[model samples]
Target: MGYLFGPVLSRRLGLSMGVDLLKYKTCNLDCVYCELGRTACLTSCRDRFVPRQKVIREIELRRAEPFDHLTFAGSGEPTLSLDLGEIVSRAKELVNSPVAVITNSTLLSSPSVRKEVSAADVVLPSLDAVSEKAFQSINRPASGLLAADMIEGLKEFRKEYSGEIWLEVMLVKGINDEEAEEIARAAESTEPDRIQLNTVVRTPAEPVEPLSEEEMRRMLEIFPGAELIPDWDWCVPDRIRDRLMELLMARPGTLEEISCHLKIDGSDAIKYCKIMENDGLISRRLHGGKLYFHAIDES
Candidate 1:
């Protein structure tokens, strides 16, 4: 699993199989709220950090695994990989699942990068700030990266890419949170299929603060139709949780199987699974071309 990890339960993308293309912590931006800590290599240059064939071979091997998306999201910005386009193309050819790329939106300014990333069925790009001050305070981008250029690049990308674009806005409390209106206007200009709003839920690289759930709710008024992605309360009902754990302890089951057995709707089943997975109570595996969840053996 050097190149591939986790058909993990993602908050947004269900059962996402992650593809890491770059070395650990290799990114152009040192974002304050990044869960992976500081950027070890902060260069804007794109190079073949890992052997391309090895990565492709891993994807080829896992082609039969069930996942909602074959995601190209590395420990750092994925577009920084020189082999992104080719690998994305290869994944699309190799897997039945939709291909996705999660980018920091810094490199989207380059036409070459935009063209390469367009190969993905879905692109989740983040825009935290529109103003230079807020951008610098939040993203801490490389020497030459500009907020204006990032915005323009997203607009350009929207024109060329035919697939779904789910624009993400990572709002940090007292940082870029003030610029929500401006960011929302900019996000709307990109014509993304969905605008997803996220705040600091994971332990951040810096000791930043997350907005209250109420604050996030009010943000819906600002960015109409934008989906909130922050972990609020993060509680799965006790009855459902116990039942899921019991079921998984008996035998592994797919989402569909779990939904049918529990007599819960698909959405509720996924929501519960995601919460349990986050709490490390359960884990997922791909078997027989389907994703199955099982309780983690503490022993």
Candidate 2:
């Protein structure tokens, strides 16, 4: 699994098989909460960091569970790989699973990058800050980038791109937190399908404080369609749709929590949840501003 790692369970994409196109930490921004330590190769220039052929070959050789997605999400911004579009296209052609790319919105400013990444079925791009001050404090993006410009690019991406865009907002205490209103406004401007509210729960690169769960819940005011990614449980099993229903039978939980609990692929999890929801095996309710699904007979 040199280039491809895990049909790793994800809180978002579930049983996501990852593709690492660039060397570790080769990115344009040094986000304050990056789990992979610091950006070892911080440059904006794009090249064949790992030969596209190698990545494609690895994915072709991969043997695992029915992955929910073939993800281009490994160390650093995946869009920085020059052949990202080709890889995305080839992955789609090679596998039946939906392809996804998790990227920071910095490179979405480029039409070429957006065009390439648009090939994915889902694109999760980060928009952690709106104003320059907060952007610098949180993401510590490359020297030449601007937050305002990045927002514009994200809006533009929504225009031409047809895939589901799950915009990620990495909230940190005091930095982006103080400016939630502004960040929410920026998130609204992008018009993403889902606005994923995440925080620094994992060990951070910097000694930054994470936002309390209550603080994150308050974010619902501005982001009406937002959902919080919970502390997901790790368990991977086959027959994901059935497994998800079985888990819900024990206790009601949010969609992402189900993904985390079962280590199910996010795409496949959502698909199964929908089927279950529609078939009346499960039902949903709003509790504490979070959507919870439960067995229909549960009290």
Candidate 3:
């Protein structure tokens, strides 16, 4: 499970099994709001960071696992992996689940890079800024990288690829929030299937600010058809939490079992379970090929 990580409950992609193509924190952009701390190996150069055959072998081994998407994400930008296209193609052959690639939209400027990324069934690309100053302040890109070129690259990508494109816009308060309208216009110009809005929800590398939900709602007017995808509120209701804890205390339950017994949606079950797990209220285990959560006996 070195290259392959969770079938984690992603808000947008559902239960996505992640594929890490690059090394830890190796990215072209040292984004101010990155959750993986700072970029350790910062470069725009694409190379074979991991063994292509090894990644494919791992994918072959895990192809039967239940997941919605075999997502190319985690650690750093997936586009930075030179073997991305071959790996993606191989994964498609080995797995029934749709393939996805999440990128920062910097390397899309290169036609070859765009071609490599287009192999995925779905592409989730981010555009946080349209102005160079905003881009530099938020993304802290490698030298010679321009926001305008990124936008143009996205536009070009739209023209070339027929696959589903869910363009994401990360808006940090005061950093790139001011240019929301411009970013939205550029995003619209790309003609993506969907435009998703996100903000700093995790503990970021830098002390950045996230916009309020009300502000995000206001932005919907600016962006027209864009959808806000941040986990804005991390609260689970007292009743649900109590019931879930009681259920887990009695006996361990897989996500499906918890959802069925509680008469809650599967996604809600995952959200509650994750929050409880983080709070040390419950613990996770894998038994008979299914993930289960049981209450921790703190006595």
Instruction: List, residue by residue over 96-159, the lDDT tens digit for candidate 2.
Output: 8889999998988899998999999999999999889998998888889999989999999999
The runs of at least 3 residues in candidate 2 whose Cα sits more than 4 Å from the true structure, single-residue gaps closed, are 232-299
- Which ten contiguous residues of candidate 1 have the minimum total lDDT? 6-15
TM-score on alpha carbons, each prediction: 0.91, 0.79, 0.88
Candidate 3 backbone collisions, by pair = none
Better of 1 and 3 by TM-score: 1
Of candidate 2, the 10-residue stretch with the lowest lDDT total is: 229-238
Winner of 2 and 3 under TM-score: 3
lDDT, model 3, position 231: 80
Residues 125-191, model 1: lDDT tens digits? 9999999999999999999999999999999999999999999999999999999999999999989
lDDT of 3 at 15: 72
Query: Sort by lDDT, best first: what order?
Result: 1, 3, 2
Q: Give the TM-score (vs. native) of candidate 3.
A: 0.88
Per-residue C-alpha lDDT of model 3 across residues 166-198, encoded as one tens digit per residue: 999998999999988889889999899999998
User: How does each model score on lDDT?
Assistant: 0.91, 0.83, 0.90
Task: Judge candidate 2 against the unseen true structure and give its global Cα lDDT, from 0 to 1.
Answer: 0.83
User: TM-score winner among the candidates?
Assistant: 1
